[model samples]
Target chain A: MKKTMTRFIPFFIMASFLVTGCNQNIKSTTTAAKPSVSTEAKKDQGPVYKGKVVGKSNKAKQISIEVGKDKDAKTVMVSFDDKTKGLEYAAAGEGAIIAYEMRDGVPFATVIKPKLATLPPGVTVITPTEVKTLIDSNKDFLLVDSRPGNRYSASHLPGAVSIPVCEMQELLQNLPKEKDKLLIFYCGGPT
Target chain B: MSTKSAGQAVKAGYKNIRVMLAGEPAWVKAGYPTYANYGWVCRGNIVLIDLRSAEKDAAARIPRSVSMPFADFADNYDEIPIKAPVVLYSDKDEETTAAMKILHDNGYKKVSLVEGNFLGWKRVGGSLEKGPVVTDVRWKRILAEGEVSVAEFERALADPKVATILDVRTKAEVASGKFPSSQHIPLDELCKDMDQFVCKIRDLQKDEKIYIHCTTGARAEMAYKELKKRDFNAFYLVAEVDCKGNDCSIEE
Candidate 1:
């Protein structure tokens, strides 16, 4: 009975980890009531902005976000303070969902959290075990390491071809010409 | 990078694209074999091991390779550093794979096999040695380019006049605490607002020394690159740092 319980311990811990991870993702991606709008969040409040952070001025205590859902999105500058949550995530190239209040026509961020970028449709995530099984079974698939060339040269998956993302444009020829062939890509891991 | 690449692949009209989310590290942790190209075997900073027999190794072996016969690898593998990037090859692919498994199973993080093995090396005209085999592994991790030694950073911290300490961590990170007499500019902010930051530091001479640091040195390196573009004599700390209300410690 003790041995059996010990074997189950790892599963229980993994289950808890998965639960926490899912909850965290849900909270960050869905906290804002409104999506892609600078409308007033509540009574006497300014507005909530959801978009990718474009530029920042730490000295000015302001971050610029390309707000809205369209390509012609306007950049809005939002100020933050010590009280602001997720200030670390307020950087260029990172997605942010900011809840702010306007004071004298200036937006002051009350809460700032990272907006997780969901994976696009058609591209699916494969586990390492699944990939290993494919290799073991002699599957006809192209496993490409999409990290830097140096990293690829240092070490990479067995039978994996090197087509670094940085050099993807120039090295497109290295990729299989047949469009229908399965192409599995991997990097340093989910960052 | 994989996701971005996969997206690009989709755009390029490739169908059935799948991303290995866990990637090489996870694959390695699962005791799977990895392969390195011949160029890496020749030039990479790795402990290349010839896993063939002592007789075969003495007869002919890859240059700069140490002989660790697969028969004796189980007992003597620990002699190689745990952190060393290990590359192995032998006449028999099975022996090479088995040796790699032993290293991975025993907590070696970076282990790979030479692509195509011994005959492959010969075909590529790889340098070779004969007569005797090197038994001992001689390796030491080197600091990356533009990196400051921890001791030097500590000295600069003690004496602010030695070098201007630049803290490139984010505002949230700084809210906890930071070192004394250090200039603050988050990496992203510095990169985005280069003109503004340059104007602020306009008074300093171009040759003035600066030591930059972040939580884990990744951001510091980025900041260092930006500073270098502006021709500032800058070096980044490549080590972990912990701070509490102006008191801090660094580790490599």
Candidate 2:
């Protein structure tokens, strides 16, 4: 028994060395390739926006705002806050300047300075038609139906997925990780 | 297998994205084909629960339905009489489906999910109840302990004994509100950040208390459960309030 154990000891050591060496090689390969994966993730960042209203709608409480139009020409629909309900209003074809910030391609008008067209850094003005056209051209973008599934199922933009904004975070993990993907969101107007 | 919009694709972290300005209206105007409503059966006695917030309840709902938002569903589950046919519908089926599963696992034997959800009901010309059907006693007992008004919560904040206030809203919501001096830890990310909570309470006695809140209280309740599971003694402060903003008004 002792002789047999001695004979197998060298084989065991050799096998262990081989397994450890292969694992090290795999680890090194993964380590060397990790930076590219992260960089790719970073490259997927969407268009960011800044700036404000460049147009308006005739309908009460409806206004057309332009932000970051020079670089991306993003346009958004805006309405007055409760405190500013009776302030001077613009008719259709009228434009107003506003300040805004957007991240991961989602835009929100943060500050509104009416009557003064102060273009912030990295901002541009674009027509609604241009915004629509830009959206149509992007094939890899993600179109989200912010309405309920019933509305989504009844009728939705071509290739859009139903994910009501109310449930955005619950479904976030299921969303793709690529940054270049455009996420377009819409509701029944403001609701 | 449904169509995707450019904006949705982008928000989903996809590289390419877009938005149809007209949204569903545009889809209809473009002459895109629509689908027929599918039928869904209630799992049991068919108590259809609308999980939309009170604000949305006024817009529309399924016939013979009760209203409860996803946030309030768990606490309110006991309010739903057990052993009845329980069906859940929401603006989005995904959320309702999730809520239904929660009910099912919690031992509600006769639960069924409404097919096509509320939208389908509307498409079929189903009648809608304006305003929420007031929650019955069963619901009140099972789901809500009532809300702590904002003013009351503010008063609590002033109390020296209220050592901590945890906000379980999503990071996005936290960033949007940036509520003064509150620690923001999304409910989903709570487990990962447990140490932060632990560290905050490390010096406190075992019976020491902490306060928690969310946009309403649903998430706060869920977070409260998780905290208890982790052996932390915490209490949830229900706001019992509706959203206040430029958006259209919705009556509960």
lDDT of 1 by residue, A1-191 (tens): 35543543453333221111010121212323212211222332446787766555554566777676556666666777889776866766555678898776667888776553233346555667879999999999999887788888989987888887777676577778999999998777311
lDDT of 2: 0.46
The DockQ of each candidate is 0.30, 0.08
Query: What is the Å distance of residue B185 in model 1 from its true position?
Result: 13
Write the residue-wise lDDT of candidate 2 on B159-234 in tens digits. 6465466666665555445445456676645644556766654364556665677655555665665576566667
In candidate 1, which residue pairs clash? none
Cα lDDT computed for each candidate against the true fold? 0.74, 0.46
Candidate 1: where are CA atoms >4 Å away?
A1-117, B123-125, B149-206, B211-232, B237-252
What does candidate 2's lDDT look like per residue over A2-39, in tens digits? 45435433533322211110001111123321212212
Pick out the ten consecutive residues of candidate 2 chain A with the lowest summed lDDT: A17-26
- lDDT, candidate 1, at A37: 19
